[model samples]
Target: MKIAWLTLCAPLLLSACTSTQTVGYGPNLEPIPGSITYGGQPRTKLTKAPVGSIVPHQFFDDFGHRVYETYVIEPDRSLRLTSRRIDYDIFND
Candidate 1:
């Protein structure tokens, strides 16, 4: 009787230990080349974008740190990078 009860509860207990949330940004954007370079390197390449368009970019460093950047495309096809934090709140209120 005890073994049967344990078997049923074991799966439930182990499921909570699993990491359901994945690291880094979601599967929507791609990383920019040479963006993860060191400080002494040249200026990072700016992604091209059309006017009034928002582009999302992700960067990963050697220390496993991730950065999410949003760029607003100017009228001249220049990208303006912003380091704004994204809100993960499900409810706006």
Candidate 2:
């Protein structure tokens, strides 16, 4: 009984250990060399848009904190994106 519960809980605990790393923009900022400014996997080097995708997306900050990266894909397939960085401290930080 205890073993079964532990087994079931192990994966959940392990998955929570996942971490995020900063993509240092200052060093690699020359138009990102090959970074797709839009139509990518939200936060990685991926180029394909997400399935059933809608725009006005989001992302994170330098410390892997939450941020919003908004984008819009027009009917004619034109892409427009903007990034807004927000810290966890809402009022004063």
Candidate 3:
């Protein structure tokens, strides 16, 4: 019974933090990815994403200085970092 309980909960524990979350348009002004403008009006209405797109991406500040790279944060508070210069797949290839 104890083994069964641990087996059932193991998947639940692992699944939650297996994803990446993104922060956009804060002090680090990454280009609003997938952003669209409603061009038919006098005022352009911008539609911004809530973050976390797996799209090959990059970041910059409002002043256009490259600052951070996208990453997945582990539940243990470790970083799985990504960047244009470092292709993680290169090793696999």
User: TM-score winner among the candidates?
Assistant: 1
Better candidate number, 1 or 2, judged by TM-score = 1
Q: Which sequence of candidate numbers ranks them by lDDT, best first? A: 1, 2, 3
Going through the candidates in the order shown, the clash numbers are 0, 1, 0
**Candidate 3 lDDT, tens digit per residue, 1-93?**
999999999998776534333444333332232221113212422234323433233444343333345443334333334432212221222
lDDT of 1 by residue, 1-93 (tens): 999999999998877553223333433434344343223323544455447687776654443444456666656555555433332322322
- lDDT to native, each model: 0.49, 0.44, 0.37
Error of model 2, residue 79, in angstroms: 1.9
Tell how far residue 16 is off in model 1, in angstroms.
Answer: 18
lDDT by residue for model 2 (1-93), tens: 999999999998876555333333222322122223533433432246653244554554445455544444444444444333344542222
Candidate 1's C-alpha runs over 4 A off are 1-49, 84-93
lDDT of 3 at 1: 100
TM-score of each: 0.38, 0.31, 0.26
How much lDDT does candidate 2 score? 0.44
Residue 46 CA error for candidate 3 (Å)? 24
Instruction: Check candidate 1 and list the clashing pairs.
Output: none
**Residue 14 lDDT in candidate 1:** 74
